[model samples]
Target chain A: MLFALRVAFRYLTANRVQSGLLIGGVALSVIVFVFMTALIRGLALFLTVQTTGQIAHVEMEPPRRIAEVMGPDARFAAQPISTFQRQQIRNWQLMVDQAEQLDHVVAVVPEVNGNGFLVRGTAVAPIALQGIDPSQIDAIIPLSKSIIDGSADLSTGGLLIGAELAEDLGLRAGVPVILRSDRGIERLIPVTGIFRIGLSNVDRRVAYLSIAVARPLLALPNGVTSVSIKLDDPALAPLIAEQLKRQLPLKVTAWQEKNRNLETALESQGRTGNFIQAFALIAIMISIASALLLTSVRRRGEIGIMRSFGISRGFVASVFVFQGVIIGLAGSLIGSALGYRLCLFLSEGITGPDGGPLLPIAPAEGGYVLVIVLTVVGSAISAILPAQAAARLDPVEAIQQ
Target chain B: MTLLKAEGITKSFRTGDIDTLVLKGVNLVLEPGEMVALSGPSGSGKSTLLNILGLLMQPSDGALSFMDKPMSGLTDKQLSAIRNTHYGFVFQFHHLLPDFTAMENVAFPAAAPAGGISAEIRDRAKMLLGRVDLTDRIDFAAMRLSGGQKQRVAIARALMNKPELVLADEPTGSLDRENSARVMALLREINHEDRTSFLISTHDPEIAKCCDRQINVVDGRIA
Candidate 1:
């Protein structure tokens, strides 16, 4: 086996142009695969960071219902939490408190969420209004750092508005703004701050108010739609979720499950990445196949001589396969290095619409290494057909040439 | 006892709609250490007969025995094993592996075993290269050698397995007159010194004249 490998090594080295072309082709494929996967993963990470930075590690809401209540002209009826529903909501909060007592949990906060319209001197836009505790908001969301214009104080009926939302409303810091809930409940509150997070969903359509003011505006007392929790370590989130499920009185969900749309989008991105990787692998395989076929044809006379001297067909096949594996490994190493550098360049240059860094790309991760290795192995396997054909050649016919 | 025997050997090939008979009812015997020459014009099936005798091809109908063992019903793998252990072949083109050195090419057959090239095999290869008067050129690549030296390396490779039978198919056909004479003389010398039997196919009458026995093949029949 060692002798066969030696001969194969010499054979490939002697054909410098052919070997170089094959290696280059394989390396190009591997680099493309690694780069595309990294891009998709980076996009997913960007979105996750944006969403998680606003909300806590987990959020709970009422289960979805598929019903439309038509009024005078097909207007949907409002689905408000009842007195009994408020008790159920309190029970859920009790569960969140229990979860905070777990070993990994750091804190938990409850918030009421509802859709409302904000108006500043006749300029009006819809917004997702979240009612949070002034003292506990920092523990759960760390929103104080994101404040741009003013503080995140929720006292004395003061509200926080996104930068874009504030601009659209024509409201300055400490200016009074009127907000109306869907149930026609109206309140006049002063804008405490204007903040920008560079996310369209957050900056354009979000407003923050105190939980005490939101309770009467949404026509619910001591009621909240969800309880969000913060963990001491992000990696222990799944374990904490399981512990909460066992301890909490009401149903509990992890952030990944509560936001199924984001999770599904991330999963689809991964699947698309896998498809791109497969395509790159196929390209490498085709290159290896063509290279091995040409090598086998060129070495026909040598193969015949070996056969006549008692070398088995299997041994002959292994020599070409070994050559392919060596080429693939070398190409993958080169491609991975190139891909990592390309990722760094892209991350540094590409920017978000707000002129912030677009994708947060780290160095080559374990996942990138795994993808390159798989591509090399796949290319080696694809060379088998050509090797078998070379091995099965007739010695007499081969030598006749 | 005769070292090799063939009775009623027949072979055919099919190309498209035509079946071509290359050998028919050929009977021959080779005693141990005997040197025989097969001579014929082109299209006379001398090469086909040599191929069948060398176990590189199978006769459509024949009864063959080597060292008292029947060869008629052997599988390809079994036949290959027997050929590797007991026979060596030399082709007209030399067919040396271009990537290998003369010494490495000569030791190729012995390197086929699972444990890889042993010290004894390397020593034997060096000794064979020395016998062919190519000790100095043993480290040279096969492509770098002269035509005569390349053929001599081919001869050394054939003797690597220490086979009982050495089959040559127009071994000197591609060489100049000087190299052709040298290769033929070397084959004759090896036969005389090692007592190894030889069956060679050649179109050159001069080469046939040097063999101990000559068999003429005409139109797929031994005449």
Candidate 2:
């Protein structure tokens, strides 16, 4: 094995110009591979975590009535429930306890959520008025950390308003606001904090108050409108939700199920990334394979002499196989390092309006390992034919040539 | 003791339906430590016979043996073992791997069997290079050496494993007069000092005259 490796190294070094070119090609391809994997996966994770970070991984709630089915025979349709039916969970505390017992369940928080109009001097903008125990909300959404102004406290019958909503109403901390529910009830609530979650749609239309303060205004006494759950692994939300459906009477919804368009968009772009990576791999393979083929042809005499001196076919083939491995490992190392720098450069150079990075690249270590493993495997595979060709040379003919 | 013996050896090649016989019923023997020459004109199968003698080719009809072991019944691996441990070859072209140094080329045959170059092998190779007067250029790559120096390194390589018999097909065929004599002298010195037998094929009578015994082959028969 040492003999073969020495010979292989000598052959590669002897043709520095050619070997350098081949190695460069492989390195470039690997760079593209690692970069794309980091970008696509990083972007996907950023979007999902950013979106799901604000929402619950799984939500358990009373099922909303399905739209009334119109019968083919108009006379046979049953009377449907009115659009104004009350929405509330039946037995929330038992279900929340049971959910906390399920595997991987991190935290469970019950909340009352409904649309309300905030009236402040003729500006009546509609906002989602959500209720939660501020301390418990930390386990689900980290709403406490998300508070950019004043405090996360809602204990004094004060509310947390969105940055955009606050700007719209000319409201701030320590200011009083009138919240009018759709049920014709009104209450004046103090603004305790302002939160900027970085999502414009949510920032423009969401407000938060304590459950004690919100439940009575919304006409719900003890039951919550829904229970939101945080899980150890958000990706496992769907499977857990599926399992929850069988055990609980309420509707169990996964984050992915609620965001189907985001899921499809994420998957389609991931496929595109994979497609690009595959072609880059093929290009790398072609470059290495052709370079080796030329090397085999040029080294025919050396192979013949080695064979005539009793070198086994397998040993000769192994020389080229070793070449593939060295090239793969070297290229992947260089490429991965460069890819990391590229992502870092892009992240720092690009910024959002609010001074945060436009593209926050969270590179997964596993992705880099995958690139190295796959590139090496692909490189070795590409060397097979050339290795075989080198091994199977006719000693007589080769020496003559 | 007879180091090698062949009886009624014949070789042929087919061109379409026409069978052209190169060697027909050729007989040969090499005694231990004796240098013998196979002389023939062009197209008279001298190199072909040399190839068969080196076990690089199979005779169409012949029984050949080295040290009383039948060569016909051995596996490819066994044949390779016989080639590496018992027989050595010096081609007309030298055929040194251009990528390696003279020392590396000399260490090749020993390295081939062991799959690595041992310290002892390197020492022996350096010693052989010294014997060939190539000590000064031992670390030079094969392509950097002159034609005769390359051939001398090839000779050192053939003897790396201390084989009993060395086969040379015009070892100096590509050299000038001075370098050719140098290469031939190196081969003779190794043959005399180590008692290694040699069977060389060439068209040069001057080279054949240096051999202890000469067999003249004409039309694939001993003349």
Best by TM-score: 1
Which residue runs of candidate 2 sit more than 4 Å off their true CA positions? A62-87, A90-108, A115-128, A134-210, A231-233, A236-252, A349-354, A364-366, B15-19
Give the lowest summed-lDDT range of ten residues in model 2 chain A.
A76-85
Best by DockQ: 1
* DockQ for all candidate structures vs. native: 0.67, 0.60
TM-score for chain B of each model, two decimals: 0.97, 0.98
Task: Encode model 1's per-residue lDDT on A1-401: one tens digit a residue.
Answer: 78767767787799888888888888788778778877777777777776666666755544444443333443454553323232226455666666667786777778877889998776889999888787885776666887889888888678888888888878777998889996689988899988776777788898888989888887768767878787766546667777766655455677776677988998998899889888888888888988899888988888887887778887898888888887888788888878887887777777778786666664454256686678667766977988898889998888876
Question: Distance from true position, residue A393, model 2, in Å?
Answer: 1.0
Q: Among the candidates, what TM-score does chain A have in each?
A: 0.81, 0.83
lDDT of 2 by residue, A233-258 (tens): 89999999998999999889999999
Task: Tell me how many residue pairs clash in candidate 1.
Answer: 0
**TM-score for model 1?**
0.88
Residue lDDT tens for model 2, B44-75: 89988988888888899988988977789777
Candidate maximizing lDDT:
2
